[model samples]
Target: MAAKKNILLIIADDLGRNLGVCGESKIKTPNLDDLAAQGTYFDMAFASTASCSGSRSVIQSGLHTHETGQLGLLRGFQGLHYFTTFDHVETSPKVFNSLGYLTGIINKVHVGPAECYPWRVREESSTRDVAWTAQRSAAFFERAKEEDKPFFLTVGYIDPHRDLTRGGFGNTQDYPGVEHLPYDPKDVTIPFFLSDVPEVRQELAEYYSAVWRMDQGVGMLLQELHRAGLDESTLVMFTSDNGPPFVNSKSTLYDAGVRLPMIIRTPGCTPGIVNPNLVSFIDILPTFLNWAGFANVKGNRKGRSVLSIMSETSPLDDWGQVFGSHTFHELTAYYPTRYMRTKRFKYHRNVAWQLDFPFPGDLYGAVSWEGMRNAEPAMIGKRPVANYIKRGPEELFDLENDPEEVHNLANDPEYNETLLDMRKALEAWQLETEDPWFFRDGISTRVIFNHIDAGMKMPDRWDFDVNSPGSKDGAIMPHSFKEVRGRGAM
Candidate 1:
């Protein structure tokens, strides 16, 4: 058998399909572009959630937030959102380390309990300082070479996340070996998820600059890999934890939040192939396991390895829809949502639709939000202010025509069958995954733990009526009640 391959996993923070490889013309990501040229690019890769910590937890444990019990940030200081991984779960580093590989992580260390990820080399540096991070990685590479062991190194870049100061994506910093390629607000491409406002443009420009810095870091790492004579033997994978840190895109269940960029260069595999097979971050652990030659794959893992389809340029028939679950981003940003997305259609079931969705701290205070917050009726993106804050119980979008997700077809009778089928599939996935937030009337099944023995059976359909059993009183159902369970809903 061929010698076990070394794995270099580079995870960018808060980046979506904004790289040069993904056809973002304005932003410069040449290193990633080159990586794509020398590897396989996944056109439809997705993150389980849009939150940084929660998404990283999903990536690490190969389980959704619901399964892993990591609903939000690991900030115990605030008290409520201090969630962590389940003790029983095996993280990526743990699994790789078990296979006799020397594992290391440089830059941001968001997901942790420390015990779960027992990386041999843990260098937490500022991801904004790409040159510095690359230097640390180069040293790690050299050490791995000297150790004569297959290594699993994760380079987590903090670039592209919202900066502490509003409208700054690390452009003001002075990195010795990095070029400050700040984008012009006039040249930046405004995503449909955001409104065409000057503030949005300015923030995007900074975000682009940060991304450029990250690209430089990627180049440095690749150069180091080549210098160590490990280029051909290393399996280099580049991806991000979540989407952009913009409001309506990061925390929301829309495609802008979950759809991500994924480029993987496997040793001796076909180069420069753009594969369209639907893939998820959950599949990453299994892929790593497969690479490490693990025979008995763990049973608790929820994803299939895409090793077979990595080389093939065509999409697979079996690669159907992907599912996602999000409980919260922060303690107060509690919006339990579940979704199932196919190539043509997308369905979302917002469990806590009655409660107005809370914003992430960074986004709330961003320059991008200035237009939305002060605009007439508090606008967010292109949607109505009220619609943006308060979501409907169910959302169905025809992605074939409305890729931007501007139009909601949940109420339209024309696509009733599509809505019903997608909803059914989403529900089936919920049951399969044992998602706890899949409760009727938005009454969290977790809360019913005390009442389960008292004949409080989990209802198939939630009763939106305030007077009904388990129904949350004084809560407004955003959508019309015509398609509810007893009315005409599937």
Candidate 2:
């Protein structure tokens, strides 16, 4: 048999499909564009969740946020530790290591319990120093070459994630000999998810600057790989954890948030093909394993390898729809939502429709959001302020006509069938996944089971507070600290 192919999976933080190859004229990404030209660029790739850690966890584990229990960030201030990964979970690194491939990761190690992800080479940092990272990766590549073993190196960059300031995207730093082609606010194209206010324009300009730097990083890494003569033997994949780091995009279930840029350059595969299949981050684990000649690596995962579809230029019949589950952004931002998106319709089921949508810390403090929030009635581009925050239980959008998702067709008489069908699909998925927060009558079914599992009497009306017993209505509230603590309902 031929030599096993190596893997280099580069994940960009908080980046959307706004690259030059993806038809965005504002930013310059020649290296990534060239890669797209020399590889297969996927148009409809998406993330299971929009948050950083949760999305990364999904990609690594081939499991949804609900399944992995990494529903939010690993940061402590948020008290979202309840959603952290359990020890029993299997990760890509674990499988790769067991298969005798030298697994390594450089920078931004966000997801984990340490034991689950046993990467042989773990260089963790949160800096956006791309050149420095490339040098470090070069050292790792040299080591891999010396070892004579096929390697799996994951390079996670901190580019394009929001900086400390509202309008900064890590552009102030000066890297050696790196030409920072600055973006003009006037020249930047505004995405539909945000209003075209001065603040938004300014922020987008900074964002473009960060994206440019990230593209430079990509160029440097690819150059290093070619120099080491590992380019052809490697299956290189470039993608992002989630969407852009802007309000209504990063934490939302909309395409602007979950939809990402995915380009794969597999060894001996046809290049420059655009596949518009509905693929997700979860599909990546299987693809990596399959490409590494370990297709049957032991793991129970929801994703399947897309190696067959990677070379296809036209859309495939089986690649029709995708599902998304986002429970929390922060522990405080408890908006349990699920979605089923097809070519024409996108359906969203917001479980806690009665409560107003919570804002992420970064988005809440953003000047762009301030501009829209202080506007007449505060509109997110064309969407109403009320619609942005206070959503109903169900929402359906005809993406073919209303690509911006500004119009809701859930209540429309013409779309009742579509709405019902999508709702049923989402409900069936929730049941299959055994989601703890599968809301029935504002009550989590798993919480009801908690009582049964605990050997406590099942409430007749299901009207006992999980918090204070006999307080009426055994509701499992996420933000209610006392409730979740007393009831042990995550």
TM per candidate comes to 0.91, 0.91
Tell me the lDDT of model 2 at 109. 76
Model 1, span 155-214: residue lDDT tens: 999888876787777778787888988678999998878888889888888899888888
lDDT of each: 0.81, 0.84
lDDT per residue, candidate 2, 72-180, as tens digits? 8877444655457767778888888888888999988788877878899999987888998899899999999899888999999999898877768888888885667
- Residue 257 error for model 2, in Å? 0.4
Worst 10-residue lDDT window, candidate 2: 475-484
